[model samples]
Target: MEKTDNIQKKIIEDVIYNAEKILEAFNNELDGVLDYSVKSLEVIDDDLLSQFHENLHDVDETMKENAIIQFGSYIFEVARRNYGGKYYWYEQLDQPILVTGQPDFEISILAFEKVKQRIENGYEDNIPFFFKGYVQKLATAKKGDKELIC
Candidate 1:
């Protein structure tokens, strides 16, 4: 009985270790893709930006799929580790408008209520242009039927 218990504990530890390694690999891959996307956007002309804007709805729809949820979970874990208990934590419910800064230096999700309040009260002029866009996207997004915001 004692040997069996020890074996079970070892198995659990191994499973957790393997899972952490997998998550690390996923984060590295995601970081590469995001870096490439940002660089590509930076080099694009105004016409291309306009084209991207025209296709924004389609892109938004794609983002709301399972990938976004998984990505949100990843982001939440990262935030929890880095920020600790400084900010309120929530799972990725619907499509969260991600507010990321230069790779992984600083990243966070904007709460739905906060986004709504910004829309009602108006954003301060000092807020960055990209963040304002994120707020707007969150405002217009349709909430997921099953996922809770908080």
Candidate 2:
């Protein structure tokens, strides 16, 4: 039991660390643009990250994966920081889902999966649109009002 707990704790730590690394990466080449704010995510949308993904094709496979992971982490951080949430391992999906809200309502953000789609589909898969919509829905559930979020 202790071993399992230790492993789970370490996994969560690494997941969060991946997100934190984005800030450092931004300073180097990613335009130093991540502020961990929801608005910042909107900036990275459109062809910004899609173009970045296209450029990654010239690099090693690890670099491509890093592009997905780094931005995926950034998206996860934005949702977690703005609305409050906890990451849980979805064993069936084999993904770390950051679930926000509870009892009254619940909104789960599949940060990594959405990032992959944004890279592939370009503007069609809007990350901010996905996140803000879910959060707004959750807030509406709780408050019984439709106030804009993000």
Candidate 3:
């Protein structure tokens, strides 16, 4: 039993690490766009600033998709590990919870709330294209010993 628990713990750690890496990659990509936006705002005129902001959004659009894919991949991998690999940490869902930097935290909360609201409202068609699969996977996951308050 001890050995089984250890193995399950390891699997959970691996999933959490993979998710964090995905977040790191997403953050790195956003950082570049944000840095450019900041620098541009410092010197550009109001008219150009609006355009810069628009362009920034255009450039960073892929990051949102990447973030969703990362979470989806995380869910898939966790399910794989628990079922296929015999590491049964699925019983303790708290193990793979993620922590983010303050700015990232704010953005994540806002994005999650938006998604949650859409899902609650039955606005299926309006869900963000990127998060659709991720949210679905999350919804289907079995509740475990660990609860995510957020």
Best-fitting candidate, scored by lDDT: 2
Candidate 1: residue pairs that collide? none
> Taking the candidates one at a time, how many backbone clashes does each contain?
0, 0, 0
Give RMSD to native, each candidate: 13.9, 4.6, 13.9
lDDT per residue (tens digit) for residues 53-140 in model 1: 3454565544333222333333333333433312322345333332333232333454333323322233331113333444344445
In candidate 1, clashing pairs total 0
lDDT of 3: 0.35
Q: What does candidate 3 score on TM?
A: 0.27
- Across 73-106, the per-residue lDDT of candidate 2 in tens digits comes to 7787788788876666767656677767754455
| lDDT for each residue of candidate 3 in 123-150, tens digit (9 for 90 to 100) | 3313333233333444454433222222
Top TM-score prediction, candidate number: 2
lDDT score, candidate 2: 0.69
Itemize residue pairs with steric clashes in candidate 2. none
Every candidate's lDDT: 0.34, 0.69, 0.35
TM-score of model 1 vs. true structure: 0.25
